[model samples]
Target: MQTPLDTLQHIFGYPSFRGEQEAIIDTLVSGEDALVLMPTGGGKSLCYQIPSLVRPGVGVVISPLIALMQDQVNALNELGVRAGFLNSTLSMEQVRETEQALLNNELDLLYVAPERLLQSRTLDLLDSAPLALFAIDEAHCVAQWGHDFRADYLRLDVLHQRFPQVPRIALTATADVRTREEIVTRLALDEARQFVAGFDRPNIQYRIQQKDNPRRQLLQFLRAEHPNQAGIVYCLSRKKVEQTAEWLCREGFNALPYHAGLPAPLRATHQSRFLREEAVIMVATIAFGMGIDKPDVRFVAHLDLPKSIEAYYQETGRAGRDGEPATALLLYGLEDVVKLRQMMSSSDGAESFKRHEQQRLTAMLGLCEVTSCRRQVLLRYFADTLEEPCGNCDTCLSPPETWDASEPVRKALSCVYRTGQRFGANHLIDVLRGSSAEKILSLGHDRLSTYGIGRDLSAEEWRSIMRQLVAAGYLDVDPEGFGGLRLTEQCRPVLRGDQPVFLRRDIKVPTARPAARRAVEEIPEADMGLWQALRACRKRLADEHGVPPYVIFHDATLRAMLEQKPLEPRQMLAISGVGDSKLERFGADFLDVIREFEYTHS
Candidate 1:
């Protein structure tokens, strides 16, 4: 029998197993179920893919989205893998062909939708096949309480009852304790070994800023940190998505909007363009990017607050999927909080469910308003404890100082009260700054004692403070009420000078200037000859495998190996990005090329 390592190299062109991948594969191969909670880009596919190839029969994969299944099938086919997907997109003729291939044992894996899998014909087909295993991708969808819940997922437990002989594996990138339990119970995975990988994506720098002229802030960020890198900017509303995309395009950025409201073909075209084009920014609503496989997104920006932290994390995880550095920026304001709360409160869920959702929303708000390390706060949400702060996040890189704002807050509160609390933050700010705008003069009665008292702080700073105040529960935005600002009871102490209010000063760190656009790094001069030879070999193998060239070995990995000239598998492991999994799986094949080079040179 071939060891898992052998299958890894022969099938996937890698040398060894990634963290817990080897263990999980070993357990599954030993006829045990497994639940894997690996983060995005953490090689979750390999755990099931490798086991499927090594085990006896065809692996049955249940996926939720047709587009996602199509992409996976396309990628596998490119690698010369006998993979096929059954979905609504397939014509009757195509479905017949796929069924014939499956029955004939010509395919290694078959991807099906949950609803399709429950069909009597599909189950009968699987019953006759030499079954290797059952794999559920995005397993968290099983939980009705999860962010992307699907009712069909609850029926997956039927697989355990019908095909008790086949081993099972459920995989998801985002799941908390509650969701995990729900998945296990729903799937009847009482005996499954659980593998939870650390959720830390150290390469991603988390940054949050209060919304003030959000467009300007986003432009500034793009100009400074990621001038020509691929990115996604998420908006809560379709109109905002369209407007933001248009604005970015007017500013000379290659941007497109994607929302459910758009025609399906237009959305598909925009998605395809984003994938193929470099440096394109996609402005989209939450409806976009469920199983996007793009590997080089440099950033993910949110123009509004996400519904919950899980949604936020999953969306942001789309960036830096290639294990390179990236950024996750959230731009939000008081209005976002109120809107989210109102949506949650009005949801047709049980009281307990509503309370749980409210708590989750509150936690997300805490993260946004936190004055400490953004990374630390994020990691804590996933139950990971970090002792020292990560210096890469905005707060850590540039710590903001705080000033006593008790008196100013009092004056601001007084103006709001005197004005009958019928105004938004902008109007209140104008009044405090003694703006002589016609509206302010007419509505504000410039004679108020608070007028012009807050001129010391800039408009941006005031907005930040107000946002924080709202998040901290000292202020509220009436959702059914025109979003008028209202002071909460918590504001009473600060107004009466019984509580100290220290406001964070806005920090103005110099932005990273955009680097001059250069061609994607080619093989360095020192290993030009070896690099050429490797490319030739990679191209030949890729052709044989019928997969994209990068599937065999990414250009960067190949370049690094060639430059370092690793003599052995262990030495290859030392190469950046060549983890133990790749070294064990593909090391010998690469070493053979190196040995040939040495022989020819001599």
Candidate 2:
């Protein structure tokens, strides 16, 4: 019988288990349940994959992502694992064939969508077959308040009820404290052992800027830092996704737009292109990239603010999954917040849900305006601790200046109050800046005491103060009216002049890309030639296999080949990603490349 570690090294070709993977695998292999909250690129799949290989029968994985299931099975089949998936993408004949494989115990792992898994025919088929253990990928989807909620997931507890003997493991890349609790309760995993690795992705550098000419800023960031690299640019709406993608294409980029409103076939084709091709920028709304397995996505840029930190983390995490240096950039305007809040206010959710969502949005706004380390704030939100400030964020790289806004905040608040606390930021700024607009003159005789009180400051300066005041809890958006500003109870002290208030002053980053600590992997000229050769070979093989290039062999694996320059078959087996199957299948082709390079260079 192969042990879990033996299966890992022999089949998966990983020399060692990462983080708590070995422990999680042990729990599952011993017929116990487990809940895992590991970050992206943290090797969550191996926690269940190894146990399935070591145990009897096929591992039944319940996932909501059809594309993810297909991608994983393709990658697993390459490693000589007998993996199959049952999803809508399959034809009726293919589904029956996959089902037969599971029943015959010919498959080591089987991926099924939550809807398909809940079907009575599928459940009955599973009843007749022996089972290793159930693995629930994206377990957070079971939570009602999760970012990617699936109604079918709410019925997943039936798995525990149906198969009381089979061990189960639930895994997700990102889930906050509330969502974690919800998953546990929803999935009936009360007795399961939980393994939570750190939420930090150190390879990703976080950068957020104010949305000043957002398209221009995005273009500048892309051209300067990640030219011709594979990345995803997220937009707030379908319209913006289309516009941004078209504009990027016009500016000489291979960009594609993806949103739910598009035809399903078109979305699938766009996603397929993004996965298969190089240097493709996917401009998508939140509708895309739930379970994308593309490993070489170099950056994730947000043209507008995300709904909350969890959504932001989940989206940005799509980049740098291969543990290479990547970037997460966000450019947002205050209007984004107002529009989001209004949308939330008008949603059909219950009051409690609205309140919780409001809190999350408040925290997100605070992150956008914070002067301290953005990574630290992000980790704290997820109930993870980073004792020291991470130096890989915008604030850490170029710390923002703080100004004592005691007097200015008081004026901003006074202006809101004097305007009956029912006017929006623009109106308040106009009143504070002493604007003589027709509407202002029409509303009053222009004799009010608070009129023109803030004339000493520029309109932009006054607008910044109002924005900060709303974000800092000194003022709140009035839900009763049309995006008006009202004072909150938390602002009583500052309003009474008892305590001081300080705010971070927004500073524009230089257009020239700084030679800062933002990780940039600079390949030497000598290694570039061999690296290109290895990549070309992989791309050629991937096209033949009808899968993504990363599915064939990750960039890291290719780089290992370049660095080691393996000569013989046995030397190729020493590579990190080379299992028995890959060595027998692809060892010769890669070794041939290495030999040619050595002969030419020597």
Candidate 3:
């Protein structure tokens, strides 16, 4: 009778549980429902995975992404966990084979998409099999209003209604207060105990810049910060996704485009290549990246503004999933706001929904303009608190300067009012900067008092003021009217000359400079050879088994082995992520590589 700790160590090769994992597992192992809100790379899987193994029967996992499901099943099979997946991606024969495995109790865990799991055939199969528990991965998709909403996920409540006795756990890496409540209501997990882990991913360094030639800015960030590193660059539109991918490739990066518009087979092929290859940059739209489980993504760069903090957090969380130091760079501008607002307003959703989306986007802009720690603002959105600023973010790294923008804000607001609020930011900025453009001349008579009063500030400066004013609710974009600027009720005090407004000083993007090369994990020169040899061995094995190299051993785990220099099976077993099955299967091979390296060096 192995205890849960024993299973965790002997099977998973981890010495102990991380942050609230043990308690969550304890509840689930005791046959209780639990809703888990953990950050990416926060060990959310172990909460249900451990319970599945410790409980009476096979664990049924409802996964949203087929690729993610396949990856998990592959990694688990490598650990000798007897895992299998049943999804549409599989052939009829493959599905039947997996079905047999489930019915025969040969599998410890089975991963299925929400739609597949809800099928009558699948439900009947599960009803006959001895079930351990139900695990819903990426449970945030259950919220219909969420950015990553899936209609199929809305039908998953039947799992509870059908398997009433089996304990269930619903998990998500990104969920705010509203999304969490939706999950509880939709999943029928209200009675389930809730475990909300801190949303901070300390390993990720946050950086946000006002968009200045966004494509070039992205190229600079990649060249300086993440040369040859595996990363994802998110664009807001499909055309941008394709163009960026093509541009990055021409710039000599291994980049590929992914979006819903791409052929399904092409998208699958690109995703497969990204997961398996090193230093592959995936340029994609918001349509991608919901259930990506890759662990070694070094950066997640945004070429446009994400609609909300939740979307931003979820997208950026894809980076550094292996708990390594990673970077998240966001480049935004006034156009992003105006364009997003236009799209939202034109959407067929109800007015209330549009208003809600507008609020969410406004919050996202506030985050972009934040002068304090990025992590602090991000966490506060999810109702979590960090005691102090995370020193890794751009704000904490190089704090921005604040200035009294009351005069400029007042001028910008007056320009909007005097122009009949019919012009967008570009035209409004032109009016303020006294541009003699034909439209400005034809529409304005060049006679307004506010015109040319903004000559003291640059055009970019005026644009920043208007954007921030909108974010601060002192102004709003009339989405129904071609994204024209309009004064909000909140602007009354400021416009009336009764209040002063301050804003972060917006600066122009700096010229691109060569980045200083960072030391590779600070590994000593002497051990570098052995590290390469270990990687080669892992890669060879991964190729032979048709799995990603990380599926053999994560870079972090390999680094641990390098540091520990394990020379025997018992010593290898003691390494984190070197579970019993791994020790039995490949411990000797890895130990031989280590021992031979020692002999050669000596």
- Which model scores highest in TM-score? 2
Cα shift from native, residue 587, model 1 (Å): 14
C-alpha positional error of residue 535 in candidate 3 after TM-score superposition, expressed in Å: 1.1
User: Residues 200-288, candidate 1, lDDT per residue (tens digit)?
Assistant: 77778888777767888899999977888889999988999999999999999999999999998898778877765558899999788
Taking all chains together, each candidate's TM-score versus the true structure is: 0.85, 0.98, 0.97
Name the lDDT of candidate 1.
0.81
lDDT of each: 0.81, 0.89, 0.88
lDDT of 2 at 502: 94
Question: Candidate 2's residue-wise lDDT over 1-602, tens digit each?
Answer: 89998898888878998889899999999999999999998999898888899999889999888866777888899989999999899999998898888888899999998899999999999999999999999888887776788999999999899999999999998899888899899999999999999899998999888777888898889999899899999998999999999999999999999999999989889999999999999999998998788989999999888999989999999999999889999988667878888988999999998988899899999999999999999999999989998888888978899999899888888878788889988888888878899989999825667788889988767767777887788888877687898889988999899989998887665797544464655668999999999998999889998889988788888888988999998888888988888888778888899899999999
- Candidate 3 local lDDT, 376-454, one digit each (tens): 9999999999998877787886789999988888888898899998788888888788889998788763789888888
Q: How far out, in Å, is residue 102 in model 3?
A: 1.4
State the local distance difference test value for candidate 2.
0.89
